[model samples]
Target: MGPHIKGKIKKTLSSLAGQSAQSLFPDLFQNESAKAESSTVIVPPPPDMNWLAHADFGEQQKRADSAPPALLALGGKPQQELIAQKLARMGYVVTTASSTAQALERLSANKYRLVFCGADAAFEEVLRFVNRLTTDQRRHIYFVLVGADLHTFYDLEALALSANLVINTRDLPSLELILIKGLRDYEQLFRPLLDILGSTP
Candidate 1:
């Protein structure tokens, strides 16, 4: 509290410095300071991981580009799933859209070789979307309308509806065969046009 006591304390602390009592005042002792510095755990910087993510993305993109062409199956869940399964088994990537808006969005975002509109779908809206597509855009897609009132493979009805094929819902059990036959005819009918346009699916 007084100058004399303070001087005594400073002298005692100075004496304890660099001595075995250095442990009592590490900041005042050079050995303790060096020891404290040496004992500090130095953490290494993290490794660069951005390249790994970029590499994975690139691989996935490559696989998607090289994979089979995609098709859209628009309908109720049951019909959409059944059609998707059949198309997938036939070596095509099938995307399902439960509503007209969803189907339109999918069509606008991606190129689909085929579009199967089910009886439950909003036919007028889907047809309007297809009708609005430019010739160049429309030519690449094979549109099919599936409904109970439609006759399977009815060229006249298909023409009226601007569809490549029309299938009766009752004939859905044989969809795979019908699709094979219809797609064969479609390719034969459009190969020349597609070739001229410089785009073939």
Candidate 2:
């Protein structure tokens, strides 16, 4: 309360801090005040209890599901650009690739929440491509094949093999509207491609 008592309290605290560092960090405290000049916060490891674990899990799921994730477009087309920009406006981060080779390079470097590939990029290429990526730790990119020329441009087997959705480049708005309503509703049109990307293992 008074100056003398305040000084005594400060002194006691200083001594206690020194003793704490000496006990916890040991020889690292050889410099004492030099290291002591740094302030620290002690956050102990979380308890192994399930309630604490559940709380953390709930927090993480809340964060992940709340925000729109990044998107990658693996083909160079005006439609892809327009669609990606539209998605970006809707709060998704978008990156585009001009070809399968470029897409491969981009895939190596970044993890996208979704991928929209030009439908013509060969089924084997997409399959072999994604197959190579599966062993990597963070391979959660959802693949969607994009093109309106499905009759002439679609690869049924390849679309079935690697993509999660087969979206007509022209149907971007309809797809978004459909997705807002329910992902299951749009799964019919997009299923062959969507299944490959959505399936685990």
Best by TM-score: 1
Runs with alpha carbons beyond 4 Å of true place in candidate 2: 1-71, 122-127, 135-139, 151-159, 178-201
Scored by CA lDDT, what does every candidate get? 0.71, 0.53
- What's the distance in Å from true for residue 121, model 1? 6.8
Name the best candidate (by lDDT).
1
Looking at model 2, residue 123 earns an lDDT score of: 29
Q: Provide the clash count, candidate 2.
A: 4
Total backbone collisions, model 1? 0
lDDT of 1 by residue, 48-135 (tens): 3233223323232222223355555455645667767777766677777767788878888888877888644465787888899998
Write candidate 2's Cα lDDT for 1-201 as tens digits: 899999999998887874665687777867776666765665444222232222223222222233455544445567866676666655566677666767777767766666666666442365466666644332455556666653212335334545555655555544444233223333444566546777431
TM per candidate comes to 0.62, 0.47
Tell me which residue pairs clash in candidate 1: none
